[model samples]
Target: MDLFDAINQRHSYRGPLLADPVPRTDLRRIIQAGLQAPSGRNAQTTEFIIIDDPVLLAKLQAMHPANQAMQQAPAMIACLIDRQPAAVYEGYNFQIEDCAAAVENMLLAITALGYASVWIDGWLRLEQRADRVAQLLMLPTDKKLQILLPIGRPAEHWPQKERKPFAQRAWFNCYGAEETPCQ
Candidate 1:
């Protein structure tokens, strides 16, 4: 799919995914897209753990009860961030921003490749889930697992949700000055 079409079609797919496995080559391509994302000061604090092992996926599913999508996905990508201070300014860590950019890139790639996925982050922040996931992946103390992307074909199609009108959400020159929508 074209870049603009992929962007327009991409949606959070929380429903079950098809049973077919995602090819390793496609997974690599998706990860490459994420790795190419621009990072703050080129710190590149983001890392990925591509999980396709059935046993491992089952364990992760057990750990995150709310992540039903992960349970059915043929493959998943765990997005990790290095907590070690890198490109820090005024005691602010840019790892979150760096990882977020990477995730967005991967999401776009997933859509372009005719696959479906959802950015799984909120569950990682709840009930010590991140800590448990980190332990399951046996990550080093400095590496933190922050997000997951379950990749596969959607079991059912969902219509794209409507977005706020461009004119209502965007402006030009000054805040709320020009309500003209982008062409």
Candidate 2:
């Protein structure tokens, strides 16, 4: 699919997913897209662990029992982030920004590949779920699980989410300015 189409089609797929496993090749392609994302100061703080094993998937499903998408997804991607990342721009680290960029890229890729996924962050933030996930993955202490994406084919179709009009959400030269700017 075209980039714009993928971007338009990409939604947080919270519905149940099919049981079919996402091929490793497609997973690699998705991750490659994420790797190609521009990191803040090129810190490239994002790392990934693709989970396709049924046992691990089952464990994750149990962890998020209330979420049908999490339970039915045939595969998942865990995005790991560096805690004490070297400040590449100023004195502050941009690990979160880097991870977000990478995730967006991967989401687009997933949509293009005919797969569906949801950016699962808020749920993981509650009750130390992310820490437990990191432990299950045997991730290093320095690497924290910042994001999780459950991926598979959707069992049902969902409508594209409505986007705000450009005039309301964006402007030209100045904040809240008209798109064309002064003549």
Candidate 3:
């Protein structure tokens, strides 16, 4: 699929994923797309840990009680942010912004590659869930787990989610000025 089509079609998939294994080449391509996202001051604090091992996947599934998507997904990408003091830019931490960009890029790539995934955040960020997940992945102390993406073929077809009308959410020049819809 083309970039525009991929963007339009991409949705958060929380349903079951097929049992088929995702090829390593495709996984690498998806990761590459994420790495290409722009970073703040070239801090490049975003890191990814690809999980495909069945045993490890099972462990991860057990770790996240609120989410079952990982239980069936053939592969997952753990988005991490390096929180070292030196990783900051302009006296601010851009880990969230940087990682979000990477996640969006990977989501589009996943769509283009004929697969589905969900950008999981809140579930992993609750309480000490992320910390436990980081431990399961054996991530270092400085590496903070921010999001998880489960990748695989969807077991059931899903339609794009309904979005707010352009006019309701967007404006021309000012915050509440004349509405200007995208062409």
Most TM-score-accurate candidate: 2
Q: Candidate 1: deviation at residue 131, Å?
A: 0.8
Query: Relative to the unseen true structure, what is the C-alpha lDDT of residue 148 in candidate 2, on a scale of 0 to 100?
Result: 96
**Residue by residue across 1-183, what tens digits does model 3's lDDT show?**
889999999998888888999999999999999999988888877899999999998888776555546678889999998757464556787878989999999999999999999888888777788898899999999788999999999888888999998878878877766756445
Q: Highest lDDT among the candidates is held by which one?
A: 2
lDDT of 1 by residue, 66-132 (tens): 6557778889999998767665666677888989999999999999998999998888888888899
Clashing residue pairs, candidate 1?
Answer: none
The global C-alpha lDDT for each of the candidates, from Candidate 1 onward, is 0.87, 0.92, 0.87
- Please say which candidate is ahead in TM-score: 2 or 3: 2
Over 50-99, each residue of candidate 2 has an lDDT whose tens digit, in order, gives 99999998999999987888989999999999877887876888889999
* Best of the two (2, 3) by lDDT: 2
Instruction: Name the lDDT of candidate 3.
Output: 0.87
lDDT for model 2, please. Answer: 0.92
TM-score winner between candidates 1 and 2:
2
Which portions of model 1 show Cα errors greater than 4 Å?
88-92, 179-183
Q: State in Å the error of residue 23, model 3.
A: 0.5
